[model samples]
Target: MPPSRQPGFENTRSNEYWFCFSSPNVESHLIISISENHYLALAKGPLVEDHVLIVPVEHMPSTLSLSSEFEVELCQFQNSLQRYCKSQGKEVIFLEWVFIRATHANLQAIPIPSSKAVIVEKAFNLASQKMGFKFVSKNFDSISDGRKFLKTQADEESSLSYAEISGGIILLHHVEEKVRFLAQFGCEVGI
Candidate 1:
């Protein structure tokens, strides 16, 4: 049987409730691994092969809202994915889109051929420019450092998107309240 749902919550639209990641009833088979506070799972309807998600077990609104402990675990997961992809002669890109009304936070990990890895940043930059937004970029020695930087920039209410490309480059774009964002922007530009 599936998890029980409250009445009038069919749309599953709020940050307060109805999270797919937190529900074991549906995606149990999709989970690849679980850490102390998070889970690594194969992304549903992945845009490409080996696409996965790193998600917090508890319903967190966004990565920016993650606690320091969660951040450490998240980084560990990222590093593991990076190493795995590297071993397979691929490069990994991690994309996190934190919407204003985001329910469960998830970071999408995408693996691409090493040959095409060079264009990841350029493609994202071009997309940003065309969409009338600018990405503020910074290079970190590790994903942990990058997460710390992102936390410093986040407050109670922040809507943003960021991509952590292989080799420790982080490109961040703050999403304005009035502007519309493509939920599949990362998938569209990644491939």
Candidate 2:
């Protein structure tokens, strides 16, 4: 069999999807590139202030959809974004909303007050507790980084995790659909 096309890209070429940063037609200002595998770029939008999108060259649907190696590559770019923003005295919140599984994936990286980073973590953890599951938190200190962590622990049974990396720590938690109530289904839910 021919190599299977990723879930979202089975019927379309990269140019057909506006969010495919890897496409030559995407006029988004190039920022930093990691390899043919991924790149970080400034997407065209009002959230242009310190807002970056970590995009994979392949058309994966979500972070959870990525294989161990892709996940590691994605996190490496995220780690780079985190450290650079920190050095500039700015903070970033990296997140992905993937309700629609047929489009390319772009992890949004936005800056916020350094102090509010803790508040964001508390809000997610508290939300998880409300849903009756403690946030499955992990720190990469024991390992080299997220790739190592996921390679050792992640599996198919893993639920979708919303990550908030702050203060050099990465916290993963489930997005409770019950709490996701009262909003239009998709991106309107707001991060």
Off by over 4 Å in 2: 1-9, 13-16, 21-25, 30-34, 46-48, 64-73, 98-100, 126-135, 142-144, 147-159, 167-169, 173-191
TM-score of each: 0.86, 0.62
Clashing pairs in 2: none
Q: How accurate is candidate 2 locally (lDDT)?
A: 0.58
The deviation in Å at residue 120 for candidate 2 is: 2.1
Name the 10 consecutive residues with the lowest summed lDDT in model 2: 181-190
Candidate closest to the true structure, highest TM-score: 1
Q: What value does the lDDT take at residue 136 in candidate 1?
A: 92
Q: Provide the clash count, candidate 2.
A: 0
- In model 1, the runs with Cα more than 4 Å from the true position are 1-25
Scored by CA lDDT, what does every candidate get? 0.79, 0.58
Task: Report backbone clashes per prediction.
Answer: 0, 0
